[model samples]
Target chain A: MPYLPTAQSFLEQSRLLISARPTTTRITTKYTLPKTSPPDPSKSKSPPPPSSEPSQPHQPQPPKATLTLKTYDPISGTCLKYETDKAAEVGRLIAALGSCGRVMAALPAKEEAVDEGAMEVDAPVKEDAEGKAKAVPKEKELKGGQGQGQHKGGEKGGGGGGGGKKKKGKK
Target chain B: MATGHLSTDEFLIRLATLFESRRSVNHGSVFLTQKRLSPHDLPKAATDTPLPPSSPFPDLHPPHPLPILIRATNGKSKDKRKDKIKLSTVIQADELEGFFMRYADVCKAGMSGLKKRDRSGRKAKGKAKKKKGASGGGVEGEKKG
Candidate 1:
Protein backbone atom coordinates (compact mmCIF):
# COMPACT_ATOMS: atom_id res chain seq x y z
CA MET A 1 0.00 0.00 0.00
CA PRO A 2 2.90 2.46 0.87
CA TYR A 3 4.67 1.77 -2.42
CA LEU A 4 1.48 2.33 -4.38
CA PRO A 5 0.85 5.72 -2.68
CA THR A 6 4.46 6.82 -3.34
CA ALA A 7 4.13 5.86 -7.03
CA GLN A 8 0.86 7.81 -7.41
CA SER A 9 2.31 10.98 -5.78
CA PHE A 10 5.43 10.71 -7.96
CA LEU A 11 3.37 10.45 -11.15
CA GLU A 12 1.23 13.49 -10.13
CA GLN A 13 4.34 15.54 -9.37
CA SER A 14 5.92 14.61 -12.74
CA ARG A 15 2.81 15.73 -14.62
CA LEU A 16 2.79 19.05 -12.82
CA LEU A 17 6.48 19.61 -13.53
CA ILE A 18 6.02 18.94 -17.23
CA SER A 19 3.15 21.46 -17.54
CA ALA A 20 4.94 24.14 -15.52
CA ARG A 21 8.17 23.78 -17.53
CA PRO A 22 6.45 24.58 -20.87
CA THR A 23 4.71 27.75 -19.52
CA THR A 24 7.93 29.10 -18.04
CA THR A 25 9.82 28.34 -21.26
CA ARG A 26 7.09 29.96 -23.38
CA ILE A 27 7.14 33.22 -21.32
CA THR A 28 10.90 33.41 -21.35
CA THR A 29 11.13 32.66 -25.09
CA LYS A 30 8.38 35.11 -26.01
CA TYR A 31 9.19 38.15 -23.81
CA THR A 32 12.63 37.99 -22.22
CA LEU A 33 14.91 37.16 -25.15
CA PRO A 34 13.36 39.65 -27.55
CA LYS A 35 13.64 42.45 -24.99
CA THR A 36 17.22 41.64 -24.07
CA SER A 37 18.42 41.76 -27.69
CA PRO A 38 20.41 44.91 -28.51
CA PRO A 39 18.22 47.68 -30.00
CA ASP A 40 18.96 48.25 -33.70
CA PRO A 41 21.51 51.06 -33.96
CA SER A 42 19.59 52.77 -36.72
CA LYS A 43 16.34 52.68 -34.73
CA SER A 44 18.02 53.98 -31.58
CA LYS A 45 19.59 56.96 -33.30
CA SER A 46 17.44 60.15 -33.23
CA PRO A 47 17.70 63.20 -35.38
CA PRO A 48 20.38 65.71 -34.34
CA PRO A 49 19.26 68.00 -31.53
CA PRO A 50 17.91 71.37 -32.54
CA SER A 51 20.47 74.13 -32.60
CA SER A 52 20.74 75.87 -29.20
CA GLU A 53 21.80 79.25 -30.55
CA PRO A 54 19.35 82.11 -30.37
CA SER A 55 17.42 82.85 -33.52
CA GLN A 56 17.72 86.14 -35.30
CA PRO A 57 15.15 88.79 -34.56
CA HIS A 58 12.51 89.38 -37.22
CA GLN A 59 12.37 92.81 -38.83
CA PRO A 60 9.32 94.47 -40.34
CA GLN A 61 9.88 94.04 -44.03
CA PRO A 62 8.54 96.34 -46.73
CA PRO A 63 5.44 95.29 -48.67
CA LYS A 64 6.17 93.36 -51.88
CA ALA A 65 3.22 94.67 -53.92
CA THR A 66 3.42 97.72 -56.16
CA LEU A 67 0.69 100.32 -56.72
CA THR A 68 0.14 102.21 -59.97
CA LEU A 69 -1.75 105.40 -60.73
CA LYS A 70 -2.82 107.29 -63.84
CA THR A 71 -1.90 110.96 -64.05
CA TYR A 72 -2.78 113.59 -66.63
CA ASP A 73 -0.13 114.35 -69.23
CA PRO A 74 -0.39 118.07 -69.90
CA ILE A 75 1.48 117.93 -73.22
CA SER A 76 -0.34 114.92 -74.61
CA GLY A 77 -3.79 115.92 -73.30
CA THR A 78 -4.09 112.28 -72.23
CA CYS A 79 -3.60 110.34 -69.06
CA LEU A 80 -0.26 108.63 -68.47
CA LYS A 81 0.32 105.66 -66.16
CA TYR A 82 2.40 106.24 -63.04
CA GLU A 83 3.30 103.89 -60.25
CA THR A 84 4.30 104.36 -56.61
CA ASP A 85 5.33 101.76 -54.07
CA LYS A 86 3.90 103.67 -51.14
CA ALA A 87 0.43 105.12 -50.61
CA ALA A 88 1.52 108.05 -48.48
CA GLU A 89 3.57 109.64 -51.20
CA VAL A 90 0.44 110.58 -53.10
CA GLY A 91 -1.14 112.28 -50.10
CA ARG A 92 2.06 114.18 -49.53
CA LEU A 93 2.06 115.38 -53.09
CA ILE A 94 -1.46 116.75 -52.80
CA ALA A 95 -0.52 118.51 -49.58
CA ALA A 96 2.56 119.97 -51.19
CA LEU A 97 0.53 121.46 -54.01
CA GLY A 98 -1.73 123.12 -51.48
CA SER A 99 1.25 124.68 -49.69
CA CYS A 100 2.76 125.80 -52.96
CA GLY A 101 -0.51 127.55 -53.75
CA ARG A 102 -0.38 129.43 -50.45
CA VAL A 103 3.20 130.43 -51.04
CA MET A 104 2.33 131.68 -54.51
CA ALA A 105 -0.57 133.75 -53.15
CA ALA A 106 1.11 135.55 -50.22
CA LEU A 107 4.03 137.13 -52.11
CA PRO A 108 4.09 139.42 -55.18
CA ALA A 109 4.12 137.46 -58.44
CA LYS A 110 7.12 139.33 -59.89
CA GLU A 111 9.25 138.75 -56.79
CA GLU A 112 8.44 135.05 -56.55
CA ALA A 113 12.04 134.07 -57.14
CA VAL A 114 13.36 136.61 -54.67
CA ASP A 115 10.81 135.56 -52.06
CA GLU A 116 11.76 131.92 -52.50
CA GLY A 117 15.43 132.86 -52.17
CA ALA A 118 14.72 134.89 -49.07
CA MET A 119 12.80 132.03 -47.56
CA GLU A 120 15.86 129.86 -48.09
CA VAL A 121 18.14 132.42 -46.37
CA ASP A 122 18.80 132.42 -42.63
CA ALA A 123 15.72 132.97 -40.45
CA PRO A 124 17.40 135.75 -38.48
CA VAL A 125 18.04 137.77 -41.62
CA LYS A 126 14.43 137.48 -42.67
CA GLU A 127 13.27 138.65 -39.24
CA ASP A 128 15.67 141.56 -39.30
CA ALA A 129 14.54 142.67 -42.73
CA GLU A 130 10.92 142.52 -41.67
CA GLY A 131 11.75 144.55 -38.56
CA LYS A 132 13.51 147.25 -40.64
CA ALA A 133 10.54 147.54 -42.96
CA LYS A 134 8.18 147.86 -39.99
CA ALA A 135 10.29 150.66 -38.48
CA VAL A 136 10.47 152.70 -41.70
CA PRO A 137 7.41 154.93 -41.00
CA LYS A 138 8.34 155.51 -37.34
CA GLU A 139 11.93 156.48 -38.24
CA LYS A 140 10.59 158.88 -40.90
CA GLU A 141 8.79 161.00 -38.25
CA LEU A 142 11.90 161.38 -36.08
CA LYS A 143 14.95 161.42 -38.39
CA GLY A 144 13.31 161.77 -41.83
CA GLY A 145 15.78 159.53 -43.65
CA GLN A 146 15.97 159.86 -47.50
CA GLY A 147 13.70 156.90 -48.37
CA GLN A 148 11.17 157.72 -45.64
CA GLY A 149 11.49 161.49 -45.92
CA GLN A 150 10.87 161.57 -49.66
CA HIS A 151 7.39 160.11 -49.31
CA LYS A 152 6.53 162.48 -46.44
CA GLY A 153 7.90 165.51 -48.36
CA GLY A 154 5.76 164.69 -51.39
CA GLU A 155 2.62 164.43 -49.29
CA LYS A 156 3.33 167.70 -47.44
CA GLY A 157 4.16 169.51 -50.66
CA GLY A 158 0.88 168.51 -52.25
CA GLY A 159 -1.32 169.28 -49.20
CA GLY A 160 0.43 172.40 -47.83
CA GLY A 161 0.80 174.10 -51.22
CA GLY A 162 -2.89 173.55 -52.00
CA GLY A 163 -3.85 175.11 -48.60
CA GLY A 164 -1.53 178.15 -49.19
CA LYS A 165 -3.10 178.80 -52.57
CA LYS A 166 -6.60 178.69 -51.05
CA LYS A 167 -5.54 181.12 -48.24
CA LYS A 168 -4.06 183.56 -50.82
CA GLY A 169 -7.31 183.56 -52.81
CA LYS A 170 -9.36 184.26 -49.62
CA LYS A 171 -7.08 187.28 -48.67
CA MET B 1 -0.50 121.72 -46.43
CA ALA B 2 2.46 121.45 -44.12
CA THR B 3 3.36 117.86 -45.16
CA GLY B 4 7.10 118.13 -45.22
CA HIS B 5 7.22 117.79 -41.45
CA LEU B 6 5.14 114.64 -41.46
CA SER B 7 6.89 111.74 -39.79
CA THR B 8 7.25 108.54 -41.71
CA ASP B 9 4.98 106.68 -39.28
CA GLU B 10 2.26 109.32 -39.60
CA PHE B 11 2.59 109.27 -43.35
CA LEU B 12 2.25 105.51 -43.43
CA ILE B 13 -0.87 105.48 -41.25
CA ARG B 14 -2.54 108.10 -43.39
CA LEU B 15 -1.62 106.21 -46.49
CA ALA B 16 -3.19 103.04 -45.11
CA THR B 17 -6.43 104.78 -44.15
CA LEU B 18 -6.64 106.59 -47.45
CA PHE B 19 -6.23 103.32 -49.24
CA GLU B 20 -8.97 101.78 -47.14
CA SER B 21 -11.39 104.59 -47.90
CA ARG B 22 -10.53 104.60 -51.58
CA ARG B 23 -10.99 100.86 -51.68
CA SER B 24 -14.48 101.21 -50.25
CA VAL B 25 -15.38 103.79 -52.86
CA ASN B 26 -14.04 101.66 -55.74
CA HIS B 27 -11.34 104.18 -56.48
CA GLY B 28 -8.68 102.92 -58.79
CA SER B 29 -4.96 103.27 -58.04
CA VAL B 30 -3.71 106.07 -55.77
CA PHE B 31 -0.93 108.36 -56.98
CA LEU B 32 1.56 110.05 -54.66
CA THR B 33 3.31 113.19 -55.84
CA GLN B 34 7.00 113.92 -55.33
CA LYS B 35 6.24 116.74 -52.89
CA ARG B 36 6.08 115.54 -49.26
CA LEU B 37 3.71 117.05 -46.72
CA SER B 38 5.04 119.14 -43.91
CA PRO B 39 5.70 116.77 -41.05
CA HIS B 40 3.71 118.95 -38.63
CA ASP B 41 0.37 118.87 -40.43
CA LEU B 42 0.56 115.19 -41.35
CA PRO B 43 -0.92 113.95 -38.11
CA LYS B 44 -4.05 116.05 -38.46
CA ALA B 45 -4.48 115.64 -42.23
CA ALA B 46 -3.90 111.90 -42.12
CA THR B 47 -6.39 110.85 -39.47
CA ASP B 48 -9.11 111.82 -37.07
CA THR B 49 -7.62 109.62 -34.38
CA PRO B 50 -6.13 111.40 -31.41
CA LEU B 51 -2.82 110.36 -29.88
CA PRO B 52 -1.94 110.17 -26.19
CA PRO B 53 -0.87 113.60 -25.03
CA SER B 54 1.60 112.20 -22.50
CA SER B 55 3.61 110.20 -24.97
CA PRO B 56 7.35 110.84 -24.98
CA PHE B 57 7.53 111.01 -28.76
CA PRO B 58 4.71 113.51 -29.12
CA ASP B 59 6.85 115.60 -31.42
CA LEU B 60 6.83 112.78 -33.88
CA HIS B 61 4.06 112.96 -36.48
CA PRO B 62 0.96 111.09 -35.39
CA PRO B 63 0.04 108.18 -37.62
CA HIS B 64 -1.14 109.01 -41.13
CA PRO B 65 -4.84 108.68 -41.93
CA LEU B 66 -4.33 107.81 -45.59
CA PRO B 67 -2.44 105.14 -47.51
CA ILE B 68 0.86 106.15 -49.08
CA LEU B 69 3.06 104.78 -51.82
CA ILE B 70 5.88 103.08 -49.98
CA ARG B 71 7.83 101.55 -52.81
CA ALA B 72 8.11 101.66 -56.58
CA THR B 73 9.55 98.77 -58.58
CA ASN B 74 10.56 100.69 -61.71
CA GLY B 75 12.03 103.66 -59.90
CA LYS B 76 15.72 104.40 -60.28
CA SER B 77 16.33 104.60 -56.52
CA LYS B 78 15.23 102.03 -53.99
CA ASP B 79 15.69 104.43 -51.09
CA LYS B 80 12.25 105.52 -49.92
CA ARG B 81 13.24 109.11 -49.28
CA LYS B 82 14.96 109.47 -52.62
CA ASP B 83 12.59 107.40 -54.71
CA LYS B 84 9.46 109.12 -53.41
CA ILE B 85 10.21 112.25 -55.40
CA LYS B 86 10.49 110.44 -58.71
CA LEU B 87 7.34 110.46 -60.89
CA SER B 88 8.07 107.03 -62.32
CA THR B 89 7.23 105.29 -59.05
CA VAL B 90 3.91 106.90 -58.32
CA ILE B 91 1.07 104.37 -58.42
CA GLN B 92 -2.38 105.26 -59.72
CA ALA B 93 -5.34 105.04 -57.31
CA ASP B 94 -6.96 102.01 -58.90
CA GLU B 95 -3.81 99.92 -58.93
CA LEU B 96 -3.10 100.57 -55.26
CA GLU B 97 -6.49 99.34 -54.12
CA GLY B 98 -6.07 96.13 -56.03
CA PHE B 99 -2.61 95.53 -54.66
CA PHE B 100 -3.61 96.07 -51.04
CA MET B 101 -6.63 93.79 -51.25
CA ARG B 102 -4.60 91.03 -52.83
CA TYR B 103 -1.81 91.40 -50.31
CA ALA B 104 -4.18 91.20 -47.37
CA ASP B 105 -5.84 88.07 -48.74
CA VAL B 106 -2.53 86.34 -49.27
CA CYS B 107 -1.39 87.14 -45.76
CA LYS B 108 -4.61 85.76 -44.30
CA ALA B 109 -4.25 82.50 -46.19
CA GLY B 110 -0.67 82.08 -45.11
CA MET B 111 -1.56 82.59 -41.46
CA SER B 112 -4.34 80.02 -41.57
CA GLY B 113 -2.07 77.45 -43.17
CA LEU B 114 0.55 77.95 -40.49
CA LYS B 115 -2.01 77.43 -37.73
CA LYS B 116 -3.28 74.23 -39.24
CA ARG B 117 0.23 72.87 -39.65
CA ASP B 118 1.08 73.64 -36.02
CA ARG B 119 -2.04 71.83 -34.73
CA SER B 120 -1.37 68.71 -36.78
CA GLY B 121 2.27 68.58 -35.67
CA ARG B 122 1.30 68.76 -31.98
CA LYS B 123 -1.20 65.91 -32.30
CA ALA B 124 1.32 63.66 -34.03
CA LYS B 125 3.99 64.33 -31.43
CA GLY B 126 1.57 63.59 -28.57
CA LYS B 127 0.57 60.21 -30.04
CA ALA B 128 4.19 59.13 -30.54
CA LYS B 129 5.10 60.06 -26.95
CA LYS B 130 2.08 58.13 -25.56
CA LYS B 131 3.02 54.99 -27.45
CA LYS B 132 6.61 55.20 -26.23
CA GLY B 133 5.45 55.60 -22.63
CA ALA B 134 3.09 52.61 -22.80
CA SER B 135 5.82 50.32 -24.17
CA GLY B 136 8.28 51.46 -21.51
CA GLY B 137 5.79 50.83 -18.66
CA GLY B 138 4.91 47.34 -19.88
CA VAL B 139 8.58 46.33 -19.95
CA GLU B 140 9.21 47.78 -16.46
CA GLY B 141 6.21 45.90 -14.95
CA GLU B 142 7.35 42.55 -16.33
CA LYS B 143 10.88 43.03 -15.03
CA LYS B 144 9.75 44.02 -11.51
CA GLY B 145 7.35 41.09 -11.04
Candidate 2:
Protein backbone atom coordinates (compact mmCIF):
# COMPACT_ATOMS: atom_id res chain seq x y z
CA MET A 1 0.00 0.00 0.00
CA PRO A 2 1.24 3.49 -0.76
CA TYR A 3 1.92 5.46 2.39
CA LEU A 4 -0.30 8.44 3.02
CA PRO A 5 0.94 11.88 2.04
CA THR A 6 2.79 13.45 4.94
CA ALA A 7 0.79 15.91 7.05
CA GLN A 8 2.65 18.92 5.61
CA SER A 9 1.26 18.45 2.12
CA PHE A 10 -2.30 18.04 3.36
CA LEU A 11 -2.27 21.35 5.19
CA GLU A 12 -0.85 23.24 2.29
CA GLN A 13 -3.05 22.15 -0.58
CA SER A 14 -6.46 21.00 0.55
CA ARG A 15 -9.69 21.92 2.27
CA LEU A 16 -12.02 19.33 3.79
CA LEU A 17 -15.65 18.82 4.62
CA ILE A 18 -17.13 16.23 6.94
CA SER A 19 -20.70 14.97 6.94
CA ALA A 20 -22.70 12.22 8.67
CA ARG A 21 -25.70 10.33 7.35
CA PRO A 22 -28.29 9.33 9.91
CA THR A 23 -29.22 5.70 10.42
CA THR A 24 -32.47 4.32 9.03
CA THR A 25 -34.55 1.42 10.24
CA ARG A 26 -36.77 -0.71 8.05
CA ILE A 27 -39.77 -2.77 9.25
CA THR A 28 -41.98 -4.84 7.02
CA THR A 29 -45.34 -6.44 7.71
CA LYS A 30 -47.35 -8.60 5.32
CA TYR A 31 -51.04 -9.40 5.71
CA THR A 32 -52.91 -12.34 4.20
CA LEU A 33 -56.61 -12.06 3.40
CA PRO A 34 -58.96 -14.94 4.04
CA LYS A 35 -60.07 -16.95 0.97
CA THR A 36 -63.87 -16.64 0.47
CA SER A 37 -65.89 -19.39 -1.26
CA PRO A 38 -68.94 -18.51 -3.32
CA PRO A 39 -72.20 -19.13 -1.44
CA ASP A 40 -74.29 -21.94 -2.96
CA PRO A 41 -77.89 -23.01 -2.18
CA SER A 42 -76.77 -26.58 -1.48
CA LYS A 43 -73.81 -25.60 0.72
CA SER A 44 -74.49 -24.43 4.23
CA LYS A 45 -72.69 -21.33 5.28
CA SER A 46 -69.24 -22.41 6.40
CA PRO A 47 -67.81 -20.69 9.42
CA PRO A 48 -65.66 -17.74 8.30
CA PRO A 49 -61.91 -18.28 8.77
CA PRO A 50 -59.83 -15.66 10.48
CA SER A 51 -58.87 -13.01 7.89
CA SER A 52 -56.45 -10.13 7.60
CA GLU A 53 -53.93 -11.81 9.84
CA PRO A 54 -50.32 -10.77 9.42
CA SER A 55 -48.49 -13.46 7.43
CA GLN A 56 -45.02 -12.15 8.20
CA PRO A 57 -43.80 -9.81 10.88
CA HIS A 58 -40.22 -8.77 10.54
CA GLN A 59 -38.14 -7.17 13.29
CA PRO A 60 -36.84 -3.73 12.60
CA GLN A 61 -33.29 -3.50 11.34
CA PRO A 62 -31.36 -0.31 11.86
CA PRO A 63 -28.31 0.35 9.78
CA LYS A 64 -25.60 2.54 11.22
CA ALA A 65 -24.91 5.96 9.79
CA THR A 66 -22.03 6.48 7.44
CA LEU A 67 -19.42 9.19 7.91
CA THR A 68 -17.82 10.88 4.96
CA LEU A 69 -14.73 13.04 4.55
CA LYS A 70 -14.28 15.11 1.45
CA THR A 71 -10.89 16.62 0.70
CA TYR A 72 -10.43 18.82 -2.30
CA ASP A 73 -7.77 21.03 -3.79
CA PRO A 74 -9.65 24.08 -4.91
CA ILE A 75 -6.83 25.31 -7.14
CA SER A 76 -6.58 22.05 -9.06
CA GLY A 77 -10.27 21.17 -8.93
CA THR A 78 -9.41 17.65 -7.79
CA CYS A 79 -11.07 15.76 -5.00
CA LEU A 80 -10.53 12.67 -2.86
CA LYS A 81 -13.43 11.14 -0.98
CA TYR A 82 -13.57 8.57 1.79
CA GLU A 83 -16.51 6.93 3.57
CA THR A 84 -16.86 4.31 6.25
CA ASP A 85 -19.54 2.74 8.45
CA LYS A 86 -16.96 1.97 11.13
CA ALA A 87 -17.28 4.27 14.12
CA ALA A 88 -13.64 4.06 15.14
CA GLU A 89 -12.41 5.29 11.81
CA VAL A 90 -14.97 8.06 11.68
CA GLY A 91 -14.04 9.31 15.13
CA ARG A 92 -10.35 9.46 14.29
CA LEU A 93 -10.80 11.49 11.17
CA ILE A 94 -13.10 13.86 12.96
CA ALA A 95 -10.65 14.35 15.78
CA ALA A 96 -7.70 14.93 13.47
CA LEU A 97 -9.61 17.41 11.38
CA GLY A 98 -10.87 19.17 14.44
CA SER A 99 -7.36 19.62 15.75
CA CYS A 100 -6.19 20.91 12.43
CA GLY A 101 -9.00 23.42 12.43
CA ARG A 102 -8.11 24.63 15.90
CA VAL A 103 -4.49 25.16 14.97
CA MET A 104 -5.41 27.03 11.85
CA ALA A 105 -7.66 29.27 13.86
CA ALA A 106 -4.88 30.06 16.31
CA LEU A 107 -2.43 31.04 13.60
CA PRO A 108 -2.04 34.66 12.58
CA ALA A 109 -3.98 35.46 9.45
CA LYS A 110 -0.84 36.67 7.73
CA GLU A 111 0.94 33.29 7.93
CA GLU A 112 -1.98 31.50 6.37
CA ALA A 113 -0.78 31.87 2.82
CA VAL A 114 2.41 29.92 2.19
CA ASP A 115 4.47 30.12 -0.98
CA GLU A 116 4.36 26.99 -3.11
CA GLY A 117 8.13 26.67 -3.18
CA ALA A 118 8.86 27.71 0.41
CA MET A 119 9.19 24.13 1.63
CA GLU A 120 11.00 22.82 -1.42
CA VAL A 121 14.76 23.24 -1.72
CA ASP A 122 14.83 23.88 -5.47
CA ALA A 123 11.56 25.67 -5.97
CA PRO A 124 12.76 29.30 -5.83
CA VAL A 125 14.61 31.67 -3.57
CA LYS A 126 11.69 34.03 -3.12
CA GLU A 127 10.22 34.18 0.38
CA ASP A 128 6.72 35.34 1.21
CA ALA A 129 5.51 37.28 4.25
CA GLU A 130 5.31 34.16 6.41
CA GLY A 131 8.82 33.17 5.46
CA LYS A 132 10.13 36.58 6.42
CA ALA A 133 8.45 36.34 9.81
CA LYS A 134 10.03 32.95 10.45
CA ALA A 135 13.46 34.27 9.52
CA VAL A 136 13.46 36.76 12.42
CA PRO A 137 13.30 33.97 15.01
CA LYS A 138 16.09 32.05 13.33
CA GLU A 139 18.26 35.11 13.47
CA LYS A 140 17.78 35.42 17.23
CA GLU A 141 18.44 31.72 17.70
CA LEU A 142 21.71 32.12 15.89
CA LYS A 143 22.78 34.77 18.44
CA GLY A 144 22.50 32.46 21.47
CA GLY A 145 18.72 32.20 21.48
CA GLN A 146 16.93 30.36 24.30
CA GLY A 147 15.90 26.66 24.47
CA GLN A 148 17.90 23.62 25.57
CA GLY A 149 20.61 22.37 23.24
CA GLN A 150 20.07 18.67 23.95
CA HIS A 151 16.34 19.00 23.50
CA LYS A 152 16.74 20.84 20.24
CA GLY A 153 19.47 18.42 19.27
CA GLY A 154 17.09 15.50 19.70
CA GLU A 155 14.59 17.31 17.50
CA LYS A 156 16.99 17.34 14.58
CA GLY A 157 15.39 14.12 13.41
CA GLY A 158 11.87 15.49 13.71
CA GLY A 159 11.70 17.69 10.62
CA GLY A 160 13.94 18.99 7.89
CA GLY A 161 13.54 22.64 8.80
CA GLY A 162 14.08 22.04 12.49
CA GLY A 163 17.28 20.15 11.74
CA GLY A 164 18.57 22.89 9.49
CA LYS A 165 17.83 25.55 12.09
CA LYS A 166 19.74 23.68 14.81
CA LYS A 167 22.77 23.34 12.58
CA LYS A 168 22.85 27.11 12.08
CA GLY A 169 22.63 27.70 15.84
CA LYS A 170 25.62 25.47 16.40
CA LYS A 171 27.73 27.35 13.87
CA MET B 1 10.74 17.33 18.67
CA ALA B 2 7.70 15.49 19.93
CA THR B 3 6.48 12.83 17.50
CA GLY B 4 3.34 14.76 16.69
CA HIS B 5 4.20 18.22 17.92
CA LEU B 6 4.85 20.35 14.90
CA SER B 7 4.37 24.05 14.25
CA THR B 8 1.28 25.11 12.36
CA ASP B 9 2.89 25.55 8.98
CA GLU B 10 4.79 22.28 9.18
CA PHE B 11 1.72 20.40 10.26
CA LEU B 12 -0.41 21.74 7.44
CA ILE B 13 2.21 21.19 4.80
CA ARG B 14 2.69 17.59 5.88
CA LEU B 15 -1.05 16.97 5.87
CA ALA B 16 -1.41 18.21 2.29
CA THR B 17 1.25 15.77 1.19
CA LEU B 18 -0.49 12.95 3.02
CA PHE B 19 -3.74 13.73 1.26
CA GLU B 20 -2.01 13.74 -2.12
CA SER B 21 -0.52 10.33 -1.44
CA ARG B 22 -3.92 8.92 -0.52
CA ARG B 23 -5.28 10.10 -3.86
CA SER B 24 -2.68 8.08 -5.78
CA VAL B 25 -4.37 4.78 -4.97
CA ASN B 26 -8.01 3.91 -5.52
CA HIS B 27 -9.41 1.06 -3.48
CA GLY B 28 -12.36 0.27 -1.25
CA SER B 29 -11.27 2.89 1.26
CA VAL B 30 -10.16 5.77 -0.95
CA PHE B 31 -12.07 6.82 -4.05
CA LEU B 32 -10.79 9.32 -6.55
CA THR B 33 -13.63 11.22 -8.11
CA GLN B 34 -14.23 9.96 -11.65
CA LYS B 35 -15.65 11.74 -14.65
CA ARG B 36 -18.46 10.04 -16.50
CA LEU B 37 -20.61 11.24 -19.40
CA SER B 38 -23.05 13.85 -18.19
CA PRO B 39 -26.75 13.72 -19.04
CA HIS B 40 -26.15 16.65 -21.35
CA ASP B 41 -23.99 14.44 -23.50
CA LEU B 42 -26.99 12.27 -24.34
CA PRO B 43 -29.42 13.06 -27.15
CA LYS B 44 -32.51 15.03 -26.20
CA ALA B 45 -34.78 11.98 -26.50
CA ALA B 46 -32.45 9.85 -24.40
CA THR B 47 -32.30 12.51 -21.75
CA ASP B 48 -36.07 12.68 -21.47
CA THR B 49 -36.60 8.88 -21.35
CA PRO B 50 -36.63 7.16 -17.98
CA LEU B 51 -35.55 3.61 -17.27
CA PRO B 52 -38.15 1.03 -18.28
CA PRO B 53 -40.28 -0.33 -15.46
CA SER B 54 -39.35 -3.90 -16.38
CA SER B 55 -35.67 -3.29 -15.83
CA PRO B 56 -34.06 -6.42 -14.38
CA PHE B 57 -32.04 -4.95 -11.50
CA PRO B 58 -34.29 -2.75 -9.44
CA ASP B 59 -31.91 -2.82 -6.48
CA LEU B 60 -29.20 -1.25 -8.57
CA HIS B 61 -31.11 1.99 -8.55
CA PRO B 62 -30.34 4.12 -5.52
CA PRO B 63 -32.84 6.36 -3.87
CA HIS B 64 -30.28 9.14 -4.10
CA PRO B 65 -27.46 8.82 -6.58
CA LEU B 66 -24.15 10.58 -6.74
CA PRO B 67 -23.52 12.92 -9.64
CA ILE B 68 -21.50 11.38 -12.46
CA LEU B 69 -19.06 13.04 -14.83
CA ILE B 70 -17.53 11.83 -18.08
CA ARG B 71 -14.09 10.26 -17.97
CA ALA B 72 -11.54 11.18 -20.56
CA THR B 73 -10.02 7.99 -21.93
CA ASN B 74 -7.43 9.66 -24.11
CA GLY B 75 -6.22 13.24 -23.96
CA LYS B 76 -9.62 14.64 -24.81
CA SER B 77 -9.87 18.35 -24.24
CA LYS B 78 -12.42 19.75 -21.83
CA ASP B 79 -15.19 22.24 -22.54
CA LYS B 80 -15.56 24.48 -19.51
CA ARG B 81 -19.27 25.17 -19.92
CA LYS B 82 -20.45 21.91 -21.47
CA ASP B 83 -18.24 19.78 -19.23
CA LYS B 84 -19.30 21.19 -15.88
CA ILE B 85 -19.03 18.33 -13.38
CA LYS B 86 -19.44 17.73 -9.66
CA LEU B 87 -16.82 15.93 -7.60
CA SER B 88 -16.74 14.37 -4.13
CA THR B 89 -14.03 12.74 -2.03
CA VAL B 90 -14.92 10.19 0.61
CA ILE B 91 -12.52 8.83 3.23
CA GLN B 92 -13.29 5.63 5.04
CA ALA B 93 -13.88 5.89 8.81
CA ASP B 94 -11.10 3.50 9.78
CA GLU B 95 -8.44 5.59 8.07
CA LEU B 96 -9.81 8.73 9.66
CA GLU B 97 -9.57 7.25 13.13
CA GLY B 98 -6.08 5.98 12.45
CA PHE B 99 -4.93 9.47 11.55
CA PHE B 100 -6.49 10.98 14.67
CA MET B 101 -4.45 8.67 16.84
CA ARG B 102 -1.29 9.37 14.90
CA TYR B 103 -1.58 13.12 15.53
CA ALA B 104 -3.37 12.93 18.84
CA ASP B 105 -0.86 14.97 20.87
CA VAL B 106 -0.63 17.83 18.44
CA CYS B 107 -4.36 17.95 18.04
CA LYS B 108 -4.95 17.93 21.76
CA ALA B 109 -2.58 20.79 22.56
CA GLY B 110 -3.24 22.90 19.48
CA MET B 111 -1.01 25.76 18.26
CA SER B 112 -0.80 27.69 21.49
CA GLY B 113 0.76 24.74 23.19
CA LEU B 114 3.41 24.51 20.51
CA LYS B 115 4.21 28.18 20.89
CA LYS B 116 4.51 27.83 24.63
CA ARG B 117 6.85 24.92 24.15
CA ASP B 118 8.91 26.89 21.68
CA ARG B 119 9.32 29.70 24.20
CA SER B 120 10.52 27.36 26.92
CA GLY B 121 12.85 25.67 24.48
CA ARG B 122 14.46 28.98 23.65
CA LYS B 123 15.16 29.67 27.32
CA ALA B 124 16.78 26.29 27.72
CA LYS B 125 19.01 26.86 24.74
CA GLY B 126 20.21 30.17 26.11
CA LYS B 127 21.15 28.60 29.44
CA ALA B 128 22.99 25.80 27.67
CA LYS B 129 24.91 28.27 25.56
CA LYS B 130 26.00 30.26 28.59
CA LYS B 131 27.30 27.14 30.29
CA LYS B 132 29.24 26.19 27.19
CA GLY B 133 30.75 29.64 26.90
CA ALA B 134 31.92 29.63 30.54
CA SER B 135 33.54 26.20 30.15
CA GLY B 136 35.25 27.21 26.94
CA GLY B 137 36.72 30.36 28.51
CA GLY B 138 38.09 28.31 31.42
CA VAL B 139 39.78 25.86 29.05
CA GLU B 140 41.46 28.71 27.13
CA GLY B 141 42.75 30.33 30.36
CA GLU B 142 44.18 27.05 31.62
CA LYS B 143 46.06 26.55 28.35
CA LYS B 144 47.63 30.06 28.59
CA GLY B 145 48.81 29.50 32.24
Model 2 misses residue B69 by how many Å?
16
**Looking at candidate 2, what TM-score does chain B attain?**
0.23
CAPRI-style docking class of model 1 based on DockQ: incorrect
lDDT string, candidate 1, A26-78, tens digits: 00000000122334656767643345313432223222233333322232333
- For candidate 2, the lDDT comes to 0.32
Kindly give the stretch of ten consecutive residues in candidate 2 chain A with the minimal lDDT sum. A20-29
lDDT of each: 0.33, 0.32
Q: Which regions in candidate 2 have their CA more than 4 angstroms from the true location?
A: A1-6, A9-113, A116-171, B1-117
How well does candidate 1 match the true structure in TM-score terms?
A: 0.20
Residue range B1-145, candidate 2, lDDT tens digits: 1122334345434544433332232111111121212234335785586545474533223233222221111111365435322222222222333333544343222211111223687899989986886677678778998
Compared with the true structure, what per-residue lDDT tens digits does model 2 show for residues A1-171? Answer: 111254333322222211111011010111111122333535647643435224433223222233333454343445444443433333234333433332222222222112222333111121221234455535433432233455467676676686467656754
RMSD of each: 43.9, 25.9
